[model samples]
Target: MARQEPLVRAASAVRTVVEQGADDGYAGLEISGDRVLLWWKGAPPPAVTDTARAAGVAVEVRAAEHSREELRAAADRLWRSSGVEHGGQLQAVKIISDGRGLEAAVRPGRKSPLAPLPELGVPVDVVEQEPPTPTSRCDDGVPWYGGLAIRPSGEWGGACGGNENLRYTCTGGFGVHIGSTEYLLTAGHCATVGETLLDGAGQYIGEATLRHAEHDLVLVRTDAADRIWDGVPGVSDFTKPVVGWVWTFPGQSLCYSGATSGANCGYTVVKDEYTKFCYEGRCWSDLIAAKRKGRFSVAGGDSGGPVFSLINNSAWIQAAGTVTGTLQQTDLLGNKTEWVIFQDFGTATRDWPGLDTINYLDPM
Candidate 1:
């Protein structure tokens, strides 16, 4: 398992330099194992190289044909022309990590192939696939911990219950404090604003006050604790207190706990700032992507669950992201693999200023 403290420092430091340095050639960055992969349109900048080296991790500077800005512009143009956002075959579009080109996801067996838009300045890598969803399949409570079952109040939802009552909705994420009010967190797609959230026992937990559909995040007004359920759900009971939160990075191993799927580990972070189109032109950027190290990591009711990294191999964890949804990728050999899509906490804080998890900096 990856430790949180060192990884947080390294990633935060590298990201700070990247944000401060207005290098146009800056393609992107990736934390591969213990080293940093710095991609650039030309040669990597010396300041960035020195910073990465100073972080006490190995550094690999890569060359790219196009800059990030150019690729983003190209992606926008592709979205406008490809009609992927307009309920077309295009599932998602993103600037590949290597910064060489853009990868466009299109539906398989569609009637018409996307036209060769020579107009796009960058090369477009097309992959036949389907788009991801909000993962609402539907979590718990007064200082409520995360990873427990929750759903729209008065609705028969979630993976719990017997017989026909097995309606799954979502899992509660980390609890946060915005100003003087405390609130629970979950995926925005799970429920609309004003819907009251309830536990399996039908106890009132909170009310959905804010929904950011574009970012796939929701804030429920209630009392929440800075802790998460790490147990096996009815089999074993264990909980972890969230010490802090960190940004997502490629190759970072993490885990998640869902109400339906329980808790599964051995997932590696795959991509950052990925832009995905769900349905009818609805799209969002800055979304994190991870590949399952095992057969499965999340399920239909896992939305809004906590994505976290272990702390020093102990039960303590650091919040990473909110479970958004999953996508299936088929290889040439007909083998299918699933990937987890989420909105990281870093993006959450950036979008909602002064927004932070309860006890975020409390001593572990």
Candidate 2:
């Protein structure tokens, strides 16, 4: 219980703003370290600040003139307006700073240089970032070690793939419902409905029956959910079932475990929402991203893995979401890095309508 004190306090303060209604300029909320961030559609009213200032935890109130979704659509239109060759290679789009505007990325070194985004009555910035290298990942086979497919005998997080010859593996946060229904959660792009999920030893476990691309999720139906285990290679111990999960925050500490990689710990969330990514030329928004504080966050085949946070010194854990993809970035100085992308459980919950108790791995 003591472990939940800070988060409990933050949630209370956040509710204070959420309860105020849209008339008060509050459009969105996210936690940032010790503070709760209340993003208003315009300048924050005095009552909002008064509530934040007096709250036990620190608070940040900012303005976003328009909702992030609106800006996301506007960004899409901006890209379409370009209509030039360069726009075709553009990777992703996202709202920037206080939701005041938008930013986009294009293939590095513009052989087909793109013009500045036309006036959209909002701040817009176009930057250069390399498009992820597109290479054929599958051709009549799948990697058994990817996506942390389950292994029989009560261990999990092995590899799950597609039924088509073009199999691509991805991991999902495992869960249980009722006394018999079992499920595995992951990104929609990882696999589709009816595809069989395999374990470490290549035994069939379940099939994906639900998916929500807008939410970046795919839910697989399984027979039994005994426990949630992570495929961290060489690490025998892992967390047990999830106790709970916190909302995404600007600077909240978080971690993840993928089939391509083991559990990655100690990183800060850059922003909570309104993030965007493109898959196979289809662009989507509303995602979470985190940087690598100690090690790389995620990679291919790691999609649909677990994004979680720990409490009580690893004695308890919470499931945030399944891995979506990574944001491969190239800074102005040409320095390249990648951050893990995730779609939290709050969104995944939509796929399963009334299911309770999300079972996730906890360190033992």
lDDT of each: 0.74, 0.57
Clashes of 1: 14
Residue 105's lDDT in candidate 1: 75
Tell me the lDDT of candidate 1: 0.74
- Minimum summed lDDT over a 10-residue window in model 2 is located at 134-143
Tell how far residue 231 is off in model 2, in angstroms.
Answer: 7.1
lDDT of 1 by residue, 279-353 (tens): 545676657788863365466778899998887566678888899888876667767677778888888887778
lDDT (Cα, 0-100) at 29 in candidate 1? 72
**Which residue runs does candidate 2 get wrong by more than 4 Å?**
1-24, 43-56, 79-89, 115-118, 132-147, 150-168, 176-181, 224-227, 234-237, 272-275, 279-282, 293-297, 328-336, 359-364
The digit string of per-residue lDDT tens for model 2 on 1-364 reads 2343465446545654554452344556666555566676866666666666676776676666776556666766765665233355456666653566776666668635665556777676667665432101111112121124442223333233332322235554646453356566667766667777665455565787877866777766765342344435334424345765555655567777765565777656775353456655655456777776333446656667677776666655666666777766555776766677777666655456654444444322
lDDT, model 1, position 20: 73
Q: How close is candidate 1 to the true structure, as a TM-score?
A: 0.87
RMSD per prediction, one decimal? 3.1, 6.8
Off by over 4 Å in 1: 3-8, 20-23, 42-50, 137-139, 159-168, 271-273, 279-282, 329-336, 360-364
State which candidate has the highest lDDT.
1
